[model samples]
Target: MTAPTDTPSATPSTPPDLDLAVLHHLRGDLEGAEAGYRAVLAASPDNATALNNLGFAAAQSGRFDEAVELYERSLAIEDGATARLNLGNVRAALGDLEGGIAELSRATELAPGDPTAYDNLGQLLMLQGRIAEAEAAWRHALAIEDGPRLRTALATAVAATGRLGEAAGLLHQALTLDPQFGAAWAQLGAVLLLRGDVASAGEALANAKRLDPDDPGPRRHLALALLSLGRTDEAVVEFGELVRLAPDDATSRVDLAVLHLSAGRAAAALTQLDRALEAGPDDDRARLHRAFALRELGRLAEADELLQAIADGDGEQADRARQALVDEAS
Candidate 1:
């Protein structure tokens, strides 16, 4: 007969707590995740893995500064790749762009196969307008493995570089592998629009909306496609829905304002810029839009004030803003 074994005692046990914390995080329970991670820390004070994982949970919950401190503590104990990635992400969120870039720039070298590091680097590069480099990094992520969730990412990078047709092809391939890929269908619609095929774009965009009715990205893009195809009334209604859903989305707000401005609705454009400025005060793009709106409304003084700031190198958004200001002044 086999001897019966007693259950393991709980004294000094931390792996159990760490496992539980990860489980809670996966289940989307932030409060439970925090409690479990803290419990693990109580038992294993210098456990670098537990500390780094704890920092990831904190960052996901939007406690960015606390996350950075935890990641730093963990790194001091053990120079881990994951901890560095988490630290870089926190720095990115805190507006320390160069610092964030530097840390992420080093993460892949420390752990070459880290998908998160590649994705983060790709996103940061996209933000910097280095589309070619971003595409390469995102492609590297796709080559790692035919995982369950990487196709949409690859398609995004492909599309960003004006290769929408390739993105559409990948989205189709993704759906063939996983029909539940809602974002893929939506992005496929964007690709179709760039290919100048509005009918197909509508179908793809409709499929995306069917899969995820609550998301705003598909609907907003569908609206743009509609406008591009000369369906003005439908576009207007779609834009209205977008504004209702994401009142603080400055990009969508600016797009809406541009549509109105193009149609000679200066007052409506001003209202959109008002909302954009309120949501993104430091956004040079929104400020430029506001200046454009002011100029259209014959408010040259207000326009000049904003334009002068852009020319003074408050923060260089693009060459056009600086040139526009110079041209107007001369």
Candidate 2:
């Protein structure tokens, strides 16, 4: 959770009550903070800092709607960057991505030197799938304050645009700045895997897995890396662990099924494929692999029927199915 910056009112005359309220807010005493802020507001309704702090307390209490109202009131009283930033975050939490972006953009303009506004704007843009704009925002933030978190964020947007080499360099820079950043290590592993540097990818992913044992992402990528390295037994073990971690993931089940089929364990492959299909009935990969498993088990008639259906479809799986049919006939 990003900490809220309940800045003191920029007014020349700072009231002691308002100062105490800020202290209460910092101490996590939302009730005391609210009472103190309200007391200040009673004396000076136009106290923008008090209003902003009250909004922060409301947000901490999960009263986002109230926080939005208070932030808007604070902005109307005095157009401060702090209120705009808080309002932007609250609006994003309320699922108003465009509103959040607008407020954060304004906050950035109001405080051009503040990196937090740019970082937040980048995040909202990323959520909206505007990758180029997100990268630009993060780049601006990085220019203001070069940090590992910002670099990692920029690398993510960079990678999304197919600039894998540039993304890898950014990740390396972030790791150098903070080697303990598991997310950067995981992202570096993914980029390396995409570049077909499976050995390096596996090593990075293993480090990520060791650092964050509960994260399934590193485990999943590590399994794929091991599979690409032709360490089938190790891949199977990792995939098995992945299955345990995310049982409802049809893609992981299909991957495990593929590994089973490659190892000539047709029965085991069929079981995993069945589960995959159950989880995602429209999964063409599971159905295609199931046909191969059936064929391996000498269920040629069922296999041909399944393959014919898939062959009539339009996709990579369909092309593979058509080729399988030709092979069977030949």
Candidate 3:
């Protein structure tokens, strides 16, 4: 169906069409919202609200550069904090960590004490392996909030930095504050694993799975805990179930393949890795695992071909492939 085709009739308040787009956004119809916003922009390129919301819509749709342009336009009209924050989010999502941090740094200048901004910084720092800076950001957020998500972020930050006990405590606190928080339970399990508390880790992971049946995180953690605890058969069954739940999640499939390899089931691992490769034809991660599994199975020629494809920049595995070749030579 077409939009209402209504245009703004008055000034000082937002356009009726802009309101409709926000409604569409609330209903999670991003495409519908995008269409509405684009129509509004056709008449008014300098509509800051429309441009800001449209940039967010584009970012959600994976058109990061388009989102960036819209954000810049919106900021040019008026220095909106959300526009800067979203530009930073899109930049981080596109793997430009330094650029993302720079954008966020500017956003902080605009709104010095925004918790969401700091929280975003923490997540980006974590991704870039800047554990110390990530922890500092999360702690700054903590001074303002003990919300479940903030706690979960704190748990991830601390756990990544080897503070497993503190991480586990934070996750447990988050879960205790809201027993239905699946993400907190999942993180708690992961922290427990780092502490070598396999049994408790399995329990917390099971709770996470129960709380959110659609989430794959708990299953993966449970599989890992089982494997580390010498329950290989059980771990294999759990990993197999993960493959069924998220058939196209290449990373989970790689975890399953690793489990199979550890259990001396190279052929089974190869089959799983093949499924991952098929699902993500251009995924360096799947290719890297396949090459290693093939090497272990004495298929050196096939492994070399796969690694060569990686080294030739067939995908994002060039760095990993080059390193693997070096390791092989040594």
Candidate 4:
């Protein structure tokens, strides 16, 4: 995940004009904040705070290139932790992961005790798959300030390292701090799923879904948990809803098809597999599943042809196709 942009607070050292800009930013008025920051810069062209804040406003508005330029300008005028952090976030948003890491590390150096900077650095490190470094950075941030968000981030890094039990403990702590934290609940649910604790995973995911109904993360995990518990009917309903929510999601379509097939609903499975294949024509799993659905529907010729083609391939799916052919012969 890209690190969130910084919204620097106004300190006593802030100029009067820049203070107004900070207020506008805090009020979620990006346009007003940008205009106010521009006004401050117009009067005092070298105001690092104005430039940095404007960069933040631009970044929030999705104008990443402009945000980067503004942040660079701010850094040129006066090197500061805020400018470096904002620049790092913008660079990460732009897909420059290495550049983002460098800027965030510089931000940490500029503000050695700033937990936010360390948290941002940790996020970038995690994105880069540097789990050990990410864990260290998150631990540093937690040492400075044990916030719920930081704990969740740390849990993610720990989970990536396969310390799922420890990760679950961290997410549990995060939820205790803020029970309404849907993300923490969702993370805990995922960790439980990894541990094969389907019952607990389902409960946690349901809580996450209740807290944030619009989030697809909890819904996906909840569906998987239901499937693991042998509640294929309930899993089918959840997967159906997921397909509706994300029509173009080939993976969900395939998952729904599998549940339908398990329920002996070959026709319904065929429909979903057809759509999945249309969305991802070269998907071996979709083709393999489609062949099974076709065979179940008594379209033996079509099924045999597809299975033969799949069996000829040197992929994992080929073994399944070959097994199906053997079962048919028997």
lDDT of each: 0.78, 0.90, 0.82, 0.89
- TM-score winner: 4
My TM-score estimates for the predictions, one after another, are 0.66, 0.80, 0.71, 0.91
Top candidate when judged by lDDT against the true structure: 2
lDDT tens digits, residue span 1-330, model 1 = 001011111225547777777778767787888788788789888988778877877777788899889989998998867777777778888878677767777887798887777778777777777778777777776777664346777777788878877888888898888887887888888888888898889889989988998789889889888887788778877787788898988888888887788888888888988998898888787788788889999999998888778767657665657888878869
Every model's Cα RMSD, please?
9.1, 3.7, 8.0, 2.2
Give, for candidate 2, the lowest lDDT window spanning 10 residues: 1-10
Inter-residue clash pairs, candidate 1: none
Q: In candidate 1, which residue ranges exceed 4 Å CA deviation?
A: 1-36, 39-44, 147-149, 228-230, 248-330
Model 3 quality (TM-score): 0.71
Q: Per-residue alpha-carbon lDDT of model 2 for 1-330, expressed as tens digits? A: 245444434355778888888788777788998999999999999888888888888888899999999999999988989899999999999999999999999999999998889898999999999999999999999999998888999999999999999999999999999999999999999999998899999999999998998888999999999988989899898888888888888899989998898888999999989988988887889999999999999999999999999999885699999999999899
Name the candidate, 1 or 3, with the larger TM-score value. Answer: 3
Per-prediction backbone clash count = 0, 0, 0, 0
lDDT of 2 at 42: 97
Model 4 over residues 86-121: C-alpha lDDT tens digits?
898889889999999999999999998999888989
Give the least accurate 10-residue stretch of model 4, judged by summed lDDT: 2-11
In candidate 4, position 25 carries an lDDT of 88
Return whichever of 1 and 4 wins on lDDT.
4
lDDT of 1 at 251: 85
TM-score result, candidate 2: 0.80
